[model samples]
Target chain A: MKTINTRRTIRKYSDKEVSDELLDRLLTEAARTQTMGNLQLYSVVVTRSMEGKERLAPAHFNQPMVTGAPVVLTICADYNRTSTWCRNRKAEPGYDNFLSFVNAATDALLYTQTFCNLAEEEGLGLCYLGTTVYMPQMIIDALNLPKLVMPVATITLGWPDEQPVLTDRLPTASFVHYETYHDYTPEDINLHYAAKEALEENRRFCEINNKETLAQIFTDIRYTKKDNEAMSEGMMEALKKQGFL
Target chain B: MKTINTRRTIRKYSDKEVSDELLDRLLTEAARTQTMGNLQLYSVVVTRSMEGKERLAPAHFNQPMVTGAPVVLTICADYNRTSTWCRNRKAEPGYDNFLSFVNAATDALLYTQTFCNLAEEEGLGLCYLGTTVYMPQMIIDALNLPKLVMPVATITLGWPDEQPVLTDRLPTASFVHYETYHDYTPEDINLHYAAKEALEENRRFCEINNKETLAQIFTDIRYTKKDNEAMSEGMMEALKKQGFL
Candidate 1:
């Protein structure tokens, strides 16, 4: 395994292309990763074509990486395969449930992360476009996805042009539990920020902004209900339409 | 990256002890894997003590690996650290949402997979216990986990006692999509099995007892609602209590 210091998100990319051979290799390794019952409940949609990336970019909040990167892969939660297996065996198909969605979605995301690690090991930069799953229809139309599949997330890969700083992390003890679910009290939260402040040493995303602590800043930006309601609605609607809800 | 064929779950461990230096390196490297916004919104709880395992085994469905393995680690979904960053600057911590849960959970799971991959590279056999997260209280009490620190999963590391067959996967076409979600007709299901039969030459999982198509057996299992309802309900309830719902 590569050292942690070498790992960082590569937003900018070199003009170099990620070949079809490499794509296949990565997907195959991804498939080899663990999944529930060896069901292989997910698939990676490799988007290297210009036309494909053009449509996929807008669906992911106009993220430049979606099209700008040489390689973009979308991991999807799939139920259609299992459903079809049931029909052929003359058994009942019942995949539309909260559990199945979580199971498949979890599998897809795990595979995507495995692929990302492999890409990084091969000297590539990558970024995961979390919003890709929200605009299911546009991406589906762009990528020509089959039925019983829904987007979990999209990852963009290429050689890095920019070196982003090591982003902030929560404290160690604040999150690690000895045994049970350890709820964070106000004091615990305060201690975490103090440590983060030490790490930041007054530095903002890059420059010193003299802003609120990382906690305050992120909370304001991350937790507002308005930021995600539409995205959630779109995802659920897409799933329902696909008979996966 | 290690070759895929070498990876296996180690259930029966030898008396040989795992070094703390290796354990620390594992946690450090694993924690550094990519996460949304570099949130690093998770932590690893490591246990090498016999007493610790004794307490944790019951929480994890009494899997022998929990107590038997030389090393066991639990990955957690953490919001406390992020919430603290908010409160430190006198800001409201609003990261408790479905999206937050999804992001943190995915991040934790990704880190866990990377850790597993790393462990495999080091010649360790790993069995990921998917049931750890299902029973929160047992884990919390056993591990002394605090609130907002939910258990995502557990893993036991040692050597393999069982060499399970390399499980077959649904075809690429069965799960992969070109652009959108594809609807599967009855024909699609039969066609997938036909291709698999050709590849496997009669060696299949569902067809072991009789001549059955992959489509028929899995469809019957996946489409049933009653099989997994209790487990699903328990998981949702645990999440809700953790402020995830």
Candidate 2:
């Protein structure tokens, strides 16, 4: 209960310092989570230096959270380590399949979640930058990422500068199923979407910034706007260039 | 340290039934550590009956853990819920993007971690069945999975019948990178692969297991195994059929 209740996305941050001890403990906790075959196919890049944060900010659409947060960590999917291992053993590296790529990416994300939970338990607020995928090349170049390594997400950590109100949730029934998938009819769509739009509007998260509902805000700024379609489209080519696909 | 240190996967069972109240509390905790945007794009499928266990056993390659554990939960990505909301708003349901699929899948896996941690803190051991992807069609059909809903992974939870030795991890250097993807030389691979093989030889996960070293096990069992290529190959086709891809 303590762990769950203490968690909140603190987008607003003061000039607070996250101690090294806390970061170490957080990484250790993240390390304890399961990895595929214990290969541990990911790495966390911690950045507290202003220069590093500056380099990352543009890639994340200049999201203020990146520069404002006391600590920023990038979780990366890394197949380079395993590839090296395969080479040493005189065997071909088996990263040709899309399955391997997905597995490694998922493993990296799982590790990120564990780290996020650990940080939250320590009273730290974090906001995950989901836009990293759109700017993978920028992040890779700025972070000097090598072949077979990709930045999946960036997480900003800092003490809460403002209290962000909790967002509303879709009813558990909307998602959970007993034995199988439940098809949604038009009525079901209306009910769920109406609830979602209302929640987005009423959500207190925007209140911290003294704004209207996110739904209305999204009307002006499409959240799914194609800001980086060209880059993501080039991802397959990038993977081929890296000899990973 | 508290929430994290308390986590342990439980596989052994006491034949004790989990009450509805307890299950509710557990699910609530499971839902707590989810991703923000409050999209909550995941679901939990709880299988309690012996018959359900019987069905799940074969789906998970007849793993004894499914039958032994008191609870078997399958975590799934649910686009159906979000699509319904779109339709109700007289909007096109575009939950078919690969990005959305990855997001929901990540959310489901993250939720699984939270639930697994909660269960462990409650003194339950867990065994995660990674075979979910290999038999997607069979599992989906058996679980009555609807369109736009797919299983990510299945976990079996219960008290421990045996005290398995703590598994050793590959040297941290083998996986963790400081700033970028580090060059893994041939020596690194040989050392790591040799170590991984040695560890697998002594570990006993279950009867009739592949039981090879990490390198051999993954190579023979996961990478080279050719039984289930059709499922993944057919996945794109299925998505196309469902108007997803």
Candidate 3:
């Protein structure tokens, strides 16, 4: 519980190597996490070699953590192994569809988080790369993922080199609804975002970016309309190519 | 750590109530979870009243846990709140797309797993209902979920009335690959699944279903090709209707 409350994403790592025995132990324990129908529709491709990390760095936008961490894990939503088994047993596989992709992806993510929590509890540091979905083709090529297998998330892991402050979040009331969703009104939106917009760091961020408001920093600079549309198109194409569309 | 390793799904619940104070505390702590850019991008709808549970029961295929548990939580991927704040701050929103939906869904799932871990640690029991995505339109109507908001998962929570055995998983080797994905061969597949197929429970399951093999039980009865295709179509329609296309 304390680990859940005090956990922070670690981006920087020391030069310590993560032993195979420890990594295997943590993953084995995390594999005990509950899954849908006990299907366990997920797999992880671990990259510990410097050459392998370098191959994956471009897909992650060359983030320092990709090369700096001792271990880089590309967690995938995998139906390949399952489908192969089904075929061998004379069962026609039906998991090459969109809903199946969502199911497998959910399983992969849940397993990733469980592994992350266990890793953090072991004093290992890690950061999740959001770029995994942005460029799936490159990751697929780099990791040699076949049909029915798609990378959903990437984590860079090693011993901690720095302790960062916890990130801020919207108040509980902002995200929790009773019985049903209570749509946010203009006043409610303002009240919910007041503290976040007023943060000194956020104010400085807008000033530095020449933005009019904190929200503009997100909409105009961080996650722009043009980029989101393009990325969405690319993701759809990748999903189709992977036979999940 | 022990919590993660020993946790099992709890579908049956006692008559004892879950205190609102305790629920809020757990949620607040779980909110500390890491997310993409700290955007959060997720919401939870808490259903406590019997009428609300009954309304949602059909969506979850009338699963007894819907009405049996002390509380049901519909965890959602939401971009409405953030977009509203952006509009209020003189910023244009552009999150009505698939990539944005994926990001929000990932955030929601990570939060769900983190909350489950913490809840299990506190001796509270919960089970995830995979039916959330299969009938999204029904849940949308029941929860009054608006545009840019989609329910991605559901959890029923309460004091445990039954202790289920730990679910079985394929060997870690089946899911973990070093450096790159080593595609499974027919021989490799047989080796990987031998233990699972050899289980007496699975053998009995196949017999009960009148199936030739374990995989036939899943392909023919549990997750059939026709059902998966139909559900995939339905899910895509719901995503479009929810403005995530």
Return whichever of 1 and 3 wins on TM-score.
Answer: 3
lDDT of 1 at B206: 57
The two-chain DockQ for each candidate, comma-separated, is 0.47, 0.40, 0.87
TM-score of each: 0.86, 0.85, 0.99
Q: Write the per-residue lDDT of candidate 3 for residues A1-245, one digit (tens) a residue.
A: 57777788898999888999999998888888777778889999999999999999998889899999999999999988889989999999899899999999999999998888889888998898989999889999999999999999999999999998877789999999999899999989888888888899998998999999988988998888898999999899999999998
Whole-model lDDT, model 3:
0.91
Query: Which has the greatest lDDT?
Result: 3
Model 1, span A143-194: residue lDDT tens = 6665667777888888888987776555456555543445567777667556
Candidate 3's displacement at residue B180, Å, is 0.8
Docking class of 2: acceptable
Interface Cα RMSD, each model: 3.1, 3.3, 0.9
Q: In candidate 3, which residue ranges exceed 4 Å CA deviation?
A: none
Ranking of all candidate structures by their DockQ, best first = 3, 1, 2
lDDT tens per residue, model 2, A75-187: 88777676666555444566545555666676787788878877887778889777777657788877787777777767899888887665556656666666555667776
What 10-residue stretch in candidate 1 chain A is worst by lDDT?
Answer: A201-210
**Per-candidate alpha-carbon RMSD to the true structure:** 3.6, 4.1, 0.9
Which ten contiguous residues of candidate 3 chain B have the minimum total lDDT? B1-10
Q: lDDT at A222 for candidate 1?
A: 48
